[model samples]
Target: MLITGRTLRSLPVLAVAALLSVQLLAPYATAQETGRTVSVGTGEPGYAVNLFGPGEVTVNAGATVTFENPWFEPHTVTFYGDTEPLAPSDPTAPVPTNPGEVVEYDGTSFLNSGFLFEDPFQVTFPDEGEFPFVCIIHPGMAGTITVVAADEDVPSQAELDAEAEAIFAQALDGLKTTAGALAAQPISEQANADGTSTWSTAVVGGLFGPSDVQQFFPASIDVGVGDTVVWESTVPTPHTVTFPAGPPPFPEDMMDPLAEETFLAASGPNDAFGGSGFVHSGVIGLDWPAGQSYEVTFTAPGTYQYICLLHADQAMVGVVNVSADDDDAEAQATPTAPATPAPGPAPTGNAGLDGSGGGNMVGMLAVGALVLLTGIAAVAARRRTAR
Candidate 1:
């Protein structure tokens, strides 16, 4: 069904009793053992941090918190109430992360993957409450842990099913929103051999990016250094523009973990200068220089990659490679145009080559949460139905 909901109007007393039994014996049935592990990935639903792996684990009393390090970046599992301060803590602090705090489990509460990290916190929950935690590496990645009371009275499975349906509806809505934002973005803005991509790659039939500037309109483009490359959004959903190098002000080459991700407003067309631009609203209109067409142009050579920031799953990325020689060669080969202007000439639709190399790296986020989300819905439904 497009939507799911249990038809049960009432949960039987026996079912409720059964659920209570399961909840009660959970703490004692199992002897002291390994801790429960969780993860919180960036850009997840309702996450404050924009990293990855905000995984969740349910626990009874005496459950431990084991945070794993799957990503190369360093991260820590922090509590909401604790404040361990120190100098030069993360400047991106404020819901992004808590820096310089005392390590909860001898820094094992944090995982840096030093040669090989096997640190796990065996701290038992021993009570019922919600504990939210996140990855210190990516900052915003966050998730929650719920400890259920041994004697707590919970509703039947059928009652929980109804509540699951409601929350699932909200999740579907979030997907729609994310898709819309994707549709509004320029899947890519490639840097051309001559510093401008004359066509939209999709308009020309290339999948990842355009091929060769030979078939482009004007056969090339022109612009000052500070000009912008405007990409038109034809499809309205399920696409993402990603940059493997992260947003610019790009470092000479930020390879090691020790280097901070660099960002800068650098140079572009006509010998003018410009910084990197973000997908403020996803859509690109004719909002460049007064005389410059939304088309790309350049006076130099460089390589650039861009992706639909929202639809990373759809694998939308574009690469732009510009060279001064490209313009020189085109200038020597092309015929001069008459100074008269009428309707715009037909665009060749040849979105020359592209470089959106950061393939849908973030696409798996939505799929990874499906199972957990379903369980959460079942649990929450029990609450709503009982009300």
Candidate 2:
């Protein structure tokens, strides 16, 4: 039934939820002069903070600074100095020298908070000097700590908290603007020559800055039975439109970096789905040249749920409601075109951080809620380049 001038009505678009809420760390008043704190990473749908909050901070000698991350994304606080820096043989493993331990600094020791570190990492500086650090996993995610003499004055803990709050607040503001644009995205559909229809949706679309979105634009859509839905990754980070019984529990199926062949290349059976077995799109998007989009045909009339394994913790989920075709149904609206974003050329070869290494590292480490699933031991080929 190819109705050229007829429009297919879609479900009412929901108002963007609190997808960008920022969790500000409460002021910590510990024994030794109440140290300052820095936010490692924060995220919500369509927005994320890649760089450290209050990227630069100043504290007096003997004062402690705690780095904390309460968001879904994982991060490492690695400090480099006179000591030659070394990345873990497995990028997913914590640095062997200081695996999950409080670090004391004299200004020259190489320090790392390891990958997927959940607990707040506290570091005390007994000597005063400017110390620079980087999240080895994420290229360009760097920050510095300026230490003054014990008697010199520095920004108080309250002041630093205010600064971090301002940074997060600004990110939230930007997220709202981007969400408005994304929520306005319409469901794209086209009637096939065989009378079946194809619907298109955006995966992690609408990037505003350095931040990578963790959302599915037009998260939900309506289609008739025998229709097909295609999910396209419009951003750089990898994502999967996977249909399992429901969102998988944390760490159970953490993306295995070694199995890039299976998870990155294979698009399991394309036969029409009546909602039983797993239908995985694998990892789609940047650097994955095999294909950057996936489609699945729905044969039954029912509601089906899907999620992006890479960002399930951030609630990167969507739904497709399929209804039986009715010859008497009338067209209620016109079809909308898919968004055409001109992303830059994909990286090739041993492209480090910005390329495959860093980008893929972030995707692999982005397992699920709170922290990386505890006690999942999998060795991944290490790539030390920045993201």
Which one wins on TM-score? 2
Q: Tell me the alpha-carbon RMSD of every candidate.
A: 19.8, 13.0
Q: How does each model score on TM-score?
A: 0.34, 0.70
Candidate 2: residue pairs that collide: 7-333, 139-386, 139-387, 353-386
lDDT of 1 by residue, 1-387 (tens): 000022011112212322233224221112234344332221122111222222344556455554433211124455533545321134322222222321333222322221111233233466677765554433334556666765544333233333433433343334333332332223223455765443232221011111011111111223324234443333211122223332333222121112222111112222222223322221221221122122333334554443332221122233444444544323322234311111122121112111111112222222322222233334445545656
**Per-residue lDDT of 147 in model 1:** 65
C-alpha RMSD (angstroms) for model 1 = 19.8
Model 2 clash tally, residue pairs: 4
Candidate 1, superposed: residue stretches over 4 Å from native:
1-35, 42-58, 68-76, 84-123, 126-130, 134-176, 185-227, 230-297, 300-316, 321-387
Give the Cα lDDT of each candidate. 0.30, 0.56
Deviation (Å) of 237 in candidate 2: 2.3
Give the Cα error of residue 306 in candidate 1, in Å: 5.3
